[model samples]
Target: MDITNFVVSARNQALLYGDYNTYHKQLAKKLHNCRKRLNIVTRNRGKFSKKEPISAEKLSENHEYLHLQLLTAERAWAHAMRFKAVHSADTKGITGRTRSHIISRLDKGARAAETLVNVLSDASTSGASDTDILEARAYASMLRGATQFEKQSWEPCLRSYATARIIYTALSTSMRGDIFKDLLSETIDPSIRYAAYQSKVPRTLAIPTIARKAFPSSDSALVEQINKLAPDLLKKSDSDAQKGQVGAPNAPQTITWRSREVKIEDAAIALALASTDTATALLEEKLASSDVTLPREMAAAYDEVLIASQDAADATKHAIDELKEEGVSQNDPRIQSLQITRTAVNYQMISWRIGRNRVLSGEHDGALLDSAPTTTRKSKKDATSRKPKIEPTGRKISRLKDKVVLYDSTLQSIDSIKELPGVAADEGLLEQLEATAKYFRALKSLSIARSHSLTDQSPNAYVLTKHAFDECQQSAALFSKHGASSSDSSPRNIEIRQADIQFLHNLLKGELQRTRAIVQIDSQRQKAAETVPPHGGSPLVQRLFEYPEGGANLNHLVDFPPKMDVIPVKPLFFDVAWNYIDYPGKEPVAATTPEPEQKTKQQAQSQKKGWFGFGR
Candidate 1:
């Protein structure tokens, strides 16, 4: 898998962790778009739009007016559905009303396409050229985009729109005046169009748009429904699975993802989970050690899980074939695997995911082990104006021990699947994997050093902290040595690198040097004490015999680490699942899955007409 996309996707998911309706609805929208794109592209029989290009167009000036109305209605209906999806994503919930209206609009839009097709079928004179057929196809494609948009199917919606743009651009070259104006009259928003066609996320993706805007937040309780529905990646999620698109007739793979992929992703996930667990544990330790209810670093602990879970979810989620732009049937099995690994991607953390949010919301002391007991509350409108007979209950709380247990259990489960067949890493991926391990080890080390500083008065705290600082330096060097920084210049990368540098300079030159200034027991008390300020100068080292509490800001020590674990990944995931057919690989259990077809670059170029894009 492209680590960057995988990380980005995972982060987006974890951010919406407590709010699943938005996430699932968004996923469903993408799936819906895939199905619509499949329907339009396969049925139309042409590269530009429908399956076939228009060979002719013969319509009187009178009939032209009716055609315009139908075409206009089709585009309008499609957009209406897309907007409905956006609303659902924003609200973090979907309504029956939204689905019903979308279905109604979709049907009308389909009818419009049929009508256009019928009208074009009758005329053999003026509108029969490739451009006319393409125009009709573009309408069909746009209509597909509309339905996909309604579902908020991310890529397919954009792909459909992009495909339409390419067709319209081609048509525009040959035709002009009212005919062209009519065709170009209703297009998707420019930003969306650009992002979709270029396969790039628009900078303003998170910003509200005129065509698709975010909805108001919904009740938190609804999240429970999603948790009940899907407990983990091990089970098929209800989001897109209910649509029957996965492993169904509309399953979208043109290539076979092999066993080797399953191995690499599983390892990456295992490490991410480990990191999350470690971070959460450290924060729990911090919470337990002090009278302070919250630590400044507590948020960072939550962040570690947020980052890790997103990576885990992305790695573990089932794959769809329609997302692939090209099939890699014939290629090196060792080198070319799906962007997602072919391993049966399964992991569970729904309860944990929900549990984390509860823990954060003060619903728990630390981790949640069970559901809340029933409770009663007083109503403002009560005649007595008193509390209800049943005792009222605030959100329940769990302990740090329980939270650690759950985190450990979660990691253990993933560890079970870490060694599926050919999941071994290549040289480059191995380096990335090692770097990930070393990175977490460094995190745990820092937590240890922090805890030591909190309690230890001996020079041990300084010694331990200095070691942790050294580990950070080594991890940064390891990342750079593995070429992560050069390959990815994202802000996250810069942050990690800079943090490491800052800590290294402070520890080696400042902290270590400060330790020498402190009064050592072996030295003359007068001389050593004179070298430094009096005791209790600063809390950071007061107990440690005079370290500065005014030392490095802890934020730099524990900001979210930039993950650069991408190995020139070819893609993920589950093709067989989408087709709803589970057949074991013909190869032996110990053997790897191999490729079947290899279309050379020459063959690809020659077959360009089969794809939807401008000639250039």
Candidate 2:
């Protein structure tokens, strides 16, 4: 019958477009139509009539009767919600009379739903399927729980909500829709948690465990029905909860940061921490089993650990937020401890993130520009006789570009660690972080230099390589003096070793020398190109620029064999200057006087003209 689907769909459609008042009006119209269809409505101003209740025996006659019963219950529920929606924003809160009125309406709805369940569960008269009966039962329990919730009856509310939770959980697994899952997250879970809190249940117990314990097992038939739907729903939760417990033998109960240890009071944080440890071990196993694991594959392995660590961090943040929301002072012991826990979890999360980036970079943190291993071919002839394939210049530079991105990410993660709480106060830790940043920066510079070299930017590559060498020297010096504080053989971020530092130092040193030599050769070539003319001039001038490849030609003086050549000169300079300067045929015009006839004509014209140029 999809009873739950029908209810949830109606609620969503009405609430999405309008509030409960609209829903109430719509339900009323439907009920009126239903009554009119049954020929039970008063006609032509006749006396008013009350609709009769739907009987269990009559429900089998037609499915409309079942719909009528559901609509009736929903109408009552919507009416109460209408009141709730109206006064929800009132500062004074619900009055005593209004609370009782809302509870009364809710009670009627719950009773109607309970009556519907009883009618649906009858084997002889009820025509509904087992699933329909189960849905009706869960719906009734939820309404009853809501009624008890408003009445401040925590124990009964907890039990009622637990019943709904269990049924919905079973239906969620078997059903194909998200209605049950949405109900659990958006409604059932929060109510159960709040009621459990009021009932003095420990906050550490998960919703599933609480639901399992509070479920009304006294009803044998309901238990049987639930068991049939989910055979191990009740049994499996026990073992799962035990396995999820922080007190379990395998689960970690405490987290240590710096010199202080804090007990993990939150179960979610402990579970996440435990999963992170498991993922770390699994990553190690995968890395050990494969001799040439691809960077993507290693990165994929690290994702699990990173996600677990992020969850732990988020859980810690949630705990701190909750404490603060309750007006807990920062100086409170709980809040202070949570702040420390937050820092520790955040540090761990960023460490794993940086570790992922480090793995994505090639061996030795990309100090050596090695091609990524893309194939796993084995040779039977000599077992170790595989030949190295020379990659193209473009492909090598492309790989280096990828490594540079990874190194940049690693550096960013290190900087984020410094921003975490309590990290700045520890000078030793700060030095370690700075050294780690320098190490990644050196690798980044090296990758950039290699790319520049591949593109024939010799000077730029030389400068970058030199900078990289200096960073490597600084990082190596720091590592040599203090070394990494952590001695764990397993890989972790900010865990630089002496051998790796020395290896990078040697690498950058060699790269600096090689790039400097290339730069010098390039500079000499440029100087020779500039000095030697493009056109073949005298062999003596060309020989002065560079040594003759075929030995000095003593017989050749002007060209290779004394051939004729044109020399460029300024032939037009004298011609251009002659135009500007006075010459015999072209004397300066200003140096000559005007003609006598023209001068006499100008005087005559001036005498003939009147004042202001009027003609006389």
Best by lDDT: 2
Model 1 C-alpha lDDT per residue in residues 44-118, reported as the tens digit of each score: 554564434222342433334334434344344535545564675655455677676775676567566645645
In candidate 2, clashing pairs total 0
Please, what are the lDDT tens digits per residue for candidate 2 over residues 138-250?
Answer: 99999999999999999999999999999998887678748998999899988998798779897666778899999999999989989988888888654466564432335
Error of 2 at 150 (Å): 2.6
Q: After superposition, how far is residue 225 of candidate 1 from its true place, in Å?
A: 30
User: Which residue pairs in model 2 clash with each other?
Assistant: none
TM-score between model 2 and native: 0.79
Please list the residue runs of candidate 1 whose C-alpha ends up more than 4 Å from where it truly belongs after superposition: 1-423, 485-509, 519-616
